[model samples]
Target: MEFFNSGLRKNITSVHPAYFIIGGFIGIHNVKYYYIFLSLIYILSVLGNTVVMTVIIVDHSLRTPKYIAVFNLAFVDLFGSSALVPKVLDTFLFDHRYISYNNCLSFLFFCFISLAMQSLNLVALSYDRLMAIIYPLHYHVKVTHRFMLFFISFLWLFVITVTLFAVGFLTRLSFCKSVVINSYFCDHGPLYRLACNDVTPNYAIFVFATGLILWTPLVFILASYCRMCYALLKISTSKERLKAFKTCTAHLSLVAIYYLPIIFVYCFGASIHPNTRILSLSLTHVIPPMLNPIIYVLQTQEIKESVKKMLKFRGRTKIATKN
Candidate 1:
């Protein structure tokens, strides 16, 4: 009720801009080169994630609860890259920085939802690993096929609802002070802080998003690994412990590639130059999606084997065709 009344008040009073100028790359020279590199990254991300998903789908062997999480992770990376990259190329490379208010909101929603789901899916993968290692006997009961679907469904709903709320609050803000957004995409912080009216709700959601999506997922993963390590210590055989830990290498590598730059950027963002901050943050978002599938394919024996089987099958079919 208060939200509606506040919306009505803001609608009558707020000076909504027709278009907002994206000034994230305003002063940087030769920045088109970076965007050009990002274009190549996007292509690789698309190809890698597509191959991962295709392998998971085509091979019935990967139909377990664990691969479901892996499939979802690959899908999220692909979806997130698709949502962000082309627009980013157009916005910076072609100098099309004037984004309409509604389009900006839509862009914010998709990008934020993808960002949220990316971390949540990692949380899902971490849970799968934790169950397999820590609760080996109950791994089936704890993370069944049905349970994984339910868990992913619930997380999707929760993430989408929260992202919508965050975007909704921006509608009530009057942005008369400025229409220049200082981030690569329509970042919540720079956009909402530009508003002239009450921004408490918007600011609150921004902080909440940072914690909920960024820090919280990393914490959950780290805690899960700690528990696994503790459990591994109880195993008397060094070989067994190493073998058990080996299963976690892919997930750990994913966490590192995804979270390290992000942590670095947010932790040291202020002291750094704005351009440097943008570059750091941009890479944080872009690099992980490209690397996730590569990490899994190279580090995980299962995926590698599946890929080999598919290639062998394809080669046999080709030979048969020749025959």
Candidate 2:
């Protein structure tokens, strides 16, 4: 009777002290191929974001508020990918699947922090564009260098405060016996699902934090676009209106790149299997950073001219050296 009761108890209690992240794409016989592919992505993402930062910092002409926001976005993308990708790479390449209790929470914390920063940076970018398009005369006064610096500082502090609150609630949750996490990384949903106690409070707080960090900036971006639209309608010439709309193409593309994957993951995550979800999430982290510079910053007329000038200067110097 005692042995039977013990078995029953084990069956009833599924919570565990620590969890194992099973990782993604277990069906692949050769994980090395995945490693090589992801490593290329990681390398490209870092290099691309770094180039944007370098261009913005070194070039005096590119020091406008718009490029400054682009620089900040690059930084967020670099940091966020750094936080998640190496660990993912290790899991697949090295087969190191075990994560400690505290590490899991830390990972989850930083993940959300990066997310908060990205959303905040997007808001800054939208505001820059909105002011430039809708209120060109007031743009200088409204988006002064000092004002942008202060806004960025406030965003970092606010996001930290909100993330701290969420992590505090996360710390209080208790895990029982079930230790295997389905996702590749330590995601909030997967982590909270392992808790033995009621997770309603955690879920509620997460919803609140998401509203503040994600939805708020999204609303701001949408409003800015609407204002831009109204301003565009006031233009009498179709050619001028089309020209004005053309300026928005890069920003609009970036917004779509960043948000669409996120919406798909959150809304349809349950319907998709775990492995596919993991791959999709990984792509979200890797692909956007890689494309941001190519799509938005590098393609700009100013940056293109700068690159050409630098190349010409280098070629001239090389010819002089040969002489």
Candidate 3:
């Protein structure tokens, strides 16, 4: 009878420790306002990324190779934000943070995959810009649809393999103590803290994986952009040079926003305080998606013109329907 009663109590009291951990970070003091902020961030991110992606897709004139890369980035950001934001909002707002073991694993898996894809896509974008600026004559012929498709496929495959290895290492350990993850999301670093077993292997794998994915690509991007900058300086016409600079500015800004926080968070390791982690994760998830649409619309004059045309068309259609 005691054994049966204990089992019943266990079943009744069982809560995913992730709930408490995330709640602690988000609901640090005021639970109500924290959730409200989280909701606002989620809604804004979804709307902004969605609008950017839709505008790119619907505008036939915007279907260039360059815009295709932008489309891929937008798509990844949309889903990437979705992977964590919704669940996070739900957890904070409603106190419904009951994710099963399987669901938690799945969430972690998708988040890692989406993030890897985003990084890889940025690298591709950098390279595309590099080719356009350095070898304008051969840009079209060299970066064909087939080449883009192949490169994207390779990027996804490489990230997937890395994710599988990381996941394998993570899942091997048992979480017998506090299962709570002390971040806004199920990041490997925070999750590892809850494990009962030795995590040296996990740390080693994480370092190697992150270095390969983040550092190597970052080096390539910086090198390419440096070369592009040198080339831009040589152009004689101020107007053409300004236009070229403007073209690359949005991409560079987006890359900086997306990557700088990530590098800071991971490279700095556990030296950062828990509160710092919460703030960093929130900014990383919230700011980029909200700003990406603004960056694209402001940078690309063609997109601005299209937006004006769209608004005018809508106004005319509304008047015609009323008449």
Alpha-carbon shift of residue 116 in model 3 (angstroms) = 1.9
- After superposition, the stretches of candidate 3 with alpha carbons farther than 4 Å from their true spots are 1-23, 237-239, 266-272
Q: What are the per-residue Cα lDDT tens digits for candidate 1 across 153-196?
A: 98899899989999988999887666778899998889898899
The lDDT of each candidate is 0.88, 0.78, 0.76
Top model by lDDT, which number?
1
lDDT pick, better of 2 and 3: 2
* Ranking of all predicted structures according to lDDT, beginning with the best and ending with the worst: 1, 2, 3
Which pairs of residues collide in model 1? Answer: none
Which wins on TM-score, candidate 1 or candidate 2?
1
Model 3 agreement with the true structure over 52-104: per-residue lDDT tens digits: 78787778988777777778778877887888778877766776655656677
The local lDDT score (0 to 100) that residue 144 gets in candidate 3 is 75
lDDT of 2: 0.78
Model 1, residue 137: distance off in Å is 2.3
lDDT winner, 1 or 3: 1
